[model samples]
Target: MKDEEIIELYFKRNERAIEETDVKYGNYLESIANNILNDDLDVEECLNDTYLKTWDKIPPTRPKVFKAFLAKIARELAFDKYRASRSKKRGNGTMHEILDELEECIPASNGVEQSILGQELENIIADYVRSLPEREAFIFLSRYFYADDITAISKKYGISKNNVSVTLSRLRAKLRTRLVKEGYLAS
Candidate 1:
């Protein structure tokens, strides 16, 4: 079923909306959930939660891009699961590693002013990403947004793992410099 049709079903409050969504996006959503969640059971739970959340959201908020909407929900649910699991047992999970890498460019300090600046910082980061070349943007999103494995990303892009790391390192440095210049980071 097309996204519009599926969305209409949701708007109509039909149960078949869930069925059609599963049929169309199950694997895609599962992959996203699995990336953050280490256990298969956790991934399944997050996917189910994503569907329920989607069912609730679509009536009031019709997404322009169904795939991205589903992905964002799946990713958030997966991250919540990951955080809960990590609180019980530390270590193990690509989400931590990905965030650690990003920590370099992001400012560590926080205050009331920082809270107010958050939206501007997000816009700066978004604009920086938009300025990147297509391949760089894809690699960045694949690694960070999707939480994909480094080895998998290397193979997908036909580049060495070291090359991927180097590219990300360079990008992070550029982002850090830009953030500092924009006063989001200390000099």
Candidate 2:
């Protein structure tokens, strides 16, 4: 079913909205969860949580892109689960590594002022990503947004692992420069 039709189902408070959403976006949501959680059981739980979230949010929130909305919910849930699990066992994973890489570029969230600044920084980064070349943007989002593994990204792009690393390093440097120029980061 199309996104509009599925959204209409939600608006009407029809239970079938969940089923239609699962049919259309289950894998996409699962992939996002899998990237963060890395455990089958955890991924499944996150996906179910995403459906419930979508159901609750749809009545008042009509998203222009349903897939992105679902994916965002799934991603945030997966991150929450990942953080909880890490507090118990700090095992390094793709999500951790990617976040660590971004830690330097993104500003620290101190207080309300920094919170607003963080949102602006996020917008700037999003715009920068959108302005990138197709291949660069794909690789950047895959590694950062989805937290895909370096080896997996290289394999998917049919490129060497070193090349991927170089590309990412350059992109991060460019981002840092842009942030500094925009006064988000101090020189």
Give candidate 2's total backbone clashes: 0
Candidate 2 per-residue lDDT over residues 55-99, each given as its tens digit: 999999999989889888998899999989999999777888888
Tens-place lDDT digits, model 1, residues 1-187? 9999999999999999999999999999999888888789999899899999999898999999999999989998988888798889887657889879999999864688878888899799889989999999988889887889889899999999999999999988999999999988887
lDDT of 2 at 66: 90
Q: Which residue pairs collide, candidate 2?
A: none
TM-score quality measure for candidate 2:
0.94
Residue-level lDDT for 73 in candidate 2: 90
TM-score, per-candidate, Cα-based: 0.91, 0.94
Go through the candidates in order and give each one's C-alpha lDDT: 0.90, 0.91
